[model samples]
Target: MKIKVINKGHHALPEYQTELSAGLDLRAVLSESKVLAPLERVLVPTGLYIELPQGYEAQVRPRSGLAFKHGLSVLNAPGTIDADYRGEIGVLLVNLSNEQFEVKDGERVAQLVIAKHETVEWEPVETLSDTERGAGGYGSTGKK
Candidate 1:
């Protein structure tokens, strides 16, 4: 699906790294390097604006390599960008490791995944249907 986007940053528009990739790498737009101290979090802008059709959303997710190698993560994993939103895309980044992480311009910091969703209306039901594992959650199912 083709999407309409406005890129105000210096870097090129986000693109899929491979043919079968489900997400596009989102680059950081910054004037200077920003240090992320351990256990600290910051909102990093992408200088991008998008116009998504109804029933669709853009998910902001963490880069796996950055999360694994540098203990960096998107604070709000899978942050949702609604179809009606028309503002700069920003990623909430958090440093989960002990060492500091430097965020530079054009650095791949997050992934953007466009997804289609359904809008549900509440039925105001009296009770939900019973299930085999009703009300069982939070590790209620034993691990293998």
Candidate 2:
């Protein structure tokens, strides 16, 4: 599936893995080299914006290697990108380690997974069937 990408900044193009074992790679577009201090958050923007296919959504996730080594992660674990949105894909990354983290241009910042969505509909009902534990609060089964 070939998606159209519009590069809004002077940065490297976003690359996609041709094989199934890999995820769509997003690159970095930085105006100047900077470091993210411990527990500091930074907004990393992708040079390219895209239009995903209808009925499908793009899930923005953190890179496993970066998270494991640098203690960095996405603020929102899995950010959702609607198919209709045509803005630059911005990722909010937080540095959990007690060190300054530098993000260089063309570095893989995140990965995108294309997935389908199910439409939901709501209907008004007069009465509903009861379950084993009707309207039970948290831990209704009992705590040991």
Candidate 3:
């Protein structure tokens, strides 16, 4: 439940008031920004470090405000933070907006959620069991 931040930024670390907070918080590095087209994706850096407890993982997710307002989002939605990754946390952000997005320093870029996971051994199965519609994807259950 404790995260370590490396550098001091223009803004404070983003915290969660609820039980599920994806990322602690981070600042944006926008001086050398990339130009993107409408709906294009760019890698946005989140300058933060993390120290997660064992058996828990951090998921890099997009902030709802950014997504709804400017179509900005995390490129690798739900990016994973491995338990052993003792490195600075960076977010891979993308501009899903039509126009070029200017992300200033200390912007609330994304959210981080701490989750519990299990390390499992892979066991091969001979045959898979069938269901009503097994492995049917992409709106197999008619669009609403």
Candidate 4:
């Protein structure tokens, strides 16, 4: 599906690194480098605004390499961008390691994944069906 986007940053539009990649890398748009101390979190702008079709949403996710190498991650993992939003894309990044991490202009900081979503309608019911694992949750099954 085609999407309408406006890029005001100095970097190219986000694109998938591989043919079968599900998400596109989103770059940071900053005038200068920004540093994040350990346990620090900041909202990094992408300078990208998008218009998604109804029943779809854009998800901002952390890059695995950054997370593994620098202990950096998205504060709100898989942050959702609703279809109706018209503002620039911003990523909430956090430093989990005990070191300072610097984010430079046009640096790949996050990934954007466009996905289809569904809305639910209320079906007020008095009772629900029963199952073997009816109310069991959170480690209900064996760890092994």
Computed on alpha carbons, the lDDT of every model, listed in order, comes to 0.96, 0.82, 0.73, 0.96
lDDT rank order: 4, 1, 2, 3
lDDT of 3 by residue, 30-99 (tens): 5564565677665666656667788988888888888899888888889998878977677778887778
lDDT tens digits, residues 24-143, model 2? 778788877658899999889886688888888888899988999998888897989899999889888889998889988777888888888987799989998999777888988664
TM-score ranking of the models: 4, 1, 2, 3
Q: Could you give candidate 4's per-residue lDDT for residues 5-107 as a string of tens digits? A: 9999989999999999999999999999999999999999999999999999999999999999999999999999999999999999999999999999988
Reference-based TM-score of each model: 0.96, 0.80, 0.76, 0.97
What is the lDDT for 52 in model 2?
A: 82
Clashing pairs in 1: none
Residue pairs clashing, model 3? 21-112, 21-113, 22-112, 22-113, 23-111, 23-112, 44-93
Q: How far does residue 25 in candidate 1 sit from its true spot (Å)? A: 0.3
Q: Backbone clashes per model, in order?
A: 0, 0, 7, 0
For candidate 2, the per-residue lDDT at 38 reads 96
